[model samples]
Target: MRIGIVNDMPMAVELLRRLVVSTREHQVAWIATNGREAVEACRRDLPDLILMDLAMPEMDGVEATRKIMAETPCSILLVTASIEANVAGVYEAMGHGALDAVDIPSVGIAGNASSQSARLLTNKIAMIGKLVRDAPSRASGRISVATDPSPQRLVAIGASAGGPAAVAKVLSAFPIDFGGAIVLVQHLDAQFIPGLADWLGQHTPLPIRAAQEKDRPQAGTVLVASSDDHLVFKSAQQLGYTSSPKDNVYRPSVDVFFESAAQWWPGSVIGVLLTGMGRDGARGLRQLRDKGHLTIAQDEATSAVYGMPKAAAAIGAAVDILPLSAIGLRIIEACGRPT
Candidate 1:
């Protein structure tokens, strides 16, 4: 796959350049020092993908991504270095149409900064390549739903990076009586999510409904987080969507739902982090794990991009790392199944 790298830092630009060179299937088509250059290059060359940096000097990645997507239309993968102190900015970039993100490794940490940087960058590049080249085509495969329905506990799932197809696979695997609530957060456009929810619901037994401002999460139904607002749970056992201050990078963030589950149901909550491109669910999953709630992540093999799951695993936030098919069964088992 041909890719473009956009970053103001000379070291980061060189690092990414080497990474793309080493990857057998990927090539760096062009390198832009700022968002303005990125936009111009994208319009000129139209690379297959872009590795964007959030904090550029002339123009930021978010605006550039918006322009590139509108005019040139290519997949964008954000690469930044400040996740510990500034994770929220990453999500803002995503909201502006950047597909996913990765942390830029510290320069000169290993024996060879160039090679180490390349190795780290290579993994992310390959994943983005998969998303750019594989997801749309692969989304057409028949989704497999689970057959048994004796379980009683419902599970709510929310994610962003690489989530659209991953959520569908897990939902499609459950049988009609899987016995629980299934809420989702896919970090998609508000106007289009209703249609996406409907499309995803067609493959699952539990019909997908958009979550109203004060609706309660009920059993045997799949409730999706509303677009343009954050979905949280109140002490009254009701779902609340508010325009309150955003906590993490993504407003309808996985952290909000997973953290709420930990608070609302404690041990009864089942939180699953699927293929995504950031750390949105990592902290919330940790909270769930600490509270003895069930936490799971989609294993690397089946993930369209494993960023979110990888983040959860890195922090010991997940109790299990399973493939897409096994996640639904794990949910059923956690909800207490016939097995």
Candidate 2:
């Protein structure tokens, strides 16, 4: 895999460079001193992936990510000095289609997690490299149509890459009495789930929290997949985590959740596929639609990556291909009226 490095600090750049070179399967494609240079470099020569920093002179990573995604459309991973400190910028960059965020590798004098951090970064890079190679085609090939009947109502949403910001935008439009139970499946590391829920809580009137074992989706509250394992409906209306699909690249896969929603949700469902990279949610969304449910996919113009929704749209999964701003309202109308 050819990887690009973008950071203002010389030490950080060197560290990243070494990390990339250390892997026999990966090599450094280019290096940029700042976000501005990154955008320009990306324009000139796009790599398989980019390790981007949030802070830089002239242009910050958030704006740079927004631009690069809109223009060149490359894979990006936020490699910052402190992910905890730059939580807002991390999500903003992700909303612009950056894949994931991690703390920069540390260089400690003695006993510390420096080596582990370095390993973590490499693992993230490898995971992203695999996703890059995956065919971004119609993912509805394996999903089977559901034949169960239901009287309740559910909104099952899936997003990746630029999900946090997009999800927040949609969730914010919901009124307190927006009475449908919501289950969100977002592609991200498990540790970040709490932060995502907290961040999203500030944007909407509904209570957003991490989904736990035996949890059932309820009205007026948002449940986010919390484990690294896949979020699925283990039994009727009971949400649980599973590690069965050991080879899935996107952990807590959107497809898994949506498939569960299609099979187990004891009600009318509205499947919403939002801004994301790859075709993670397309199949499951189509399954929902096949069961005579309303399904919405975010349009390319409003998407950060446009890969997942594009895949969904290509396979005739979405009943409506709407922009980001209009998705929430559509869901509310479909869900608010009790099918």
Candidate 3:
């Protein structure tokens, strides 16, 4: 893939450059020190993918991404150190057509700098490449259709690093009246909970809203995990949104929600782990599979960040590992009439 990287931090630039070189599937098409230069570079060269930094001098990544999307319409993956602090801005960038954001890697990890960076960069490049190539058309293809007569099955979704766009793609494919409660756990900040919900609501038919404390799962709605809260299920299928005071490092943790649903919903749940950067959902999805629930992992071919789902698949957690486009159909089929 032809790639462009735009960031002001020399350390970040070096790390990403090393990673890109190691991937071998990617070529650094351009390197810009700021968003203005990034926009100009993209406009002129039209690289297939861009690794954009959120904070930079002389125009921010958001505006530059907007302009690049307007002019060149390529993929922009945000490489940032402060994803928690910029949830709203990141969502805004995704809404403006930036494909995904990844946490900036530390330069001091214990490995050969170039080789390690190259591996990291290669994984990200491939993930975002697929999302950029596939998500736009998938988003455009969403429609509301009548649900078939099947048991009331719930949709369980999990995501991480570049999950926002993937989550939007899956949900936007369904109508507001799509039969089943949709529970989503995306690693995000408590501060940007409202914005994330609101942003997704504007693009999908389902009422994308934050999961309220003690609320129950219901059909015709999409429930997002609140910032800093692990959305769990209580007795009789009620929602439990509470601070995760345990050892979990991820707020709005996917593992907790997926595990809780595995216990509470049992055979009726349909679990999905989409594009992400970590293994948080792997164990939980495994639990769901043990309980006879149907589980699906987004295949490497259609993931923006394949870490989470790939991890799940590695553990044999999924009944199938399919592309992004086929996932909605699988969910619809799961909610369809019995044979």
Candidate 4:
């Protein structure tokens, strides 16, 4: 894969270069000293992926990402010195189409922290590379029509990349008496889950909290997957997190959770696949649709990144492909008011 590096610090750039070269699977396509230069470089020559620094001179990574996505779209991964410090900027970049974020691996370090950072960077790049290579071309596809005979009472939502804000928008539309429980799986770092839950709760009428082990879904409440382990439903009334699928790329995988709902939830389920960079929820949404569940995907026009929904639409997994604004209304119609 051809990867571009964008950072103002010389040492950080070199470290990233070394890491990319060491992998052998990827080569540095270009290097930019600042955000402005990165934007110009992308306009001239877009690479398969970009490792972008949040803070830079002339322009910031967030602005650069917005421009690049508008001018010459490409996969972008935020590589910053401190993720906690730049969490806001990280999410902003994601809202502008950046795929994910990770702390830049430190130079001349040999400890476990350094090793873990290195592994995370490499894994993220590889995963994004696959997403780019396997992305489906846009084409009008057929939607499968299916409906369960059982009463609908569960809403499973899956999102990534630009999910936090999108999830907030959807949840904010639900009334305090929403009829179904909402189970959400978002691809976020474990440390940020609580912050995200708090952030979303401020904008929504329904109660939002992290999913707990053995907890059952409750109407009018949004239970978010909060751990690095994948969240799954062991039965119709029980939720649990597990590390069994350690090999999966995205932890708290949307696919894992959606599949579990398909297996255990006999009641009518509504599966939603929102803006994201990978195909995690596509197949699982298909599984739900096959079982007569109503499935929806966010349309490309309103999605920050159209990869996941595109994949779902390609496979006829989504029964309806609507824009972001319309999704909330659709959910309400399907699930009805909280009982």
Query: What value does the lDDT take at residue 31 in candidate 1?
Result: 92
TM-score of 2: 0.92
User: Which residue pairs come into collision in candidate 1?
Assistant: 145-173, 146-173, 154-180, 154-181, 161-276
Q: Identify the candidate with maximal lDDT.
A: 2
> What is the lDDT for 185 in model 3?
87
Q: Rank the candidates by lDDT, best first.
A: 2, 4, 3, 1
Candidate maximizing TM-score: 2
Which of 1 and 3 is the better model by TM-score? 3
Error of 4 at 101 (Å): 1.1
lDDT of 3 by residue, 1-339 (tens): 788889998878877777777656778898999999998887689887889988889988888876776666676778787777787679767645565566777555553344454455466567666544433222115444465333267789988655776777777678666877788988765556687887788768778788888876777788888857688888647888767646565567788988889777633888999876557788899999998888999887666445677778888999989987788878877776442
Residues 183-277, candidate 2, lDDT per residue (tens digit)?
A: 89999998888888888998998899999999887877789999989999987778899997998888989898888888988778889999887
Whole-model Cα lDDT per candidate? 0.70, 0.86, 0.74, 0.83
How well is each residue in 199-314 modelled by candidate 1, as lDDT tens digits?
A: 67767867788888777666678888876677788753678876665534465777877777778752267888886665677888899889877789888777655567777888
Candidate 2 lDDT for residue 205? 82
The Cα error of candidate 1 at residue 37, in Å, is 20
Off by over 4 Å in 4: 109-113, 137-152, 337-339
Mark the regions of model 3 whose C-alpha exceeds 4 Å error after superposition.
Answer: 1-32, 35-89, 92-151
* Alpha carbon lDDT at 133, candidate 4: 73
| Model 1 per-residue lDDT at 303 | 61
Candidate 4: residue 160 lDDT (0-100): 85
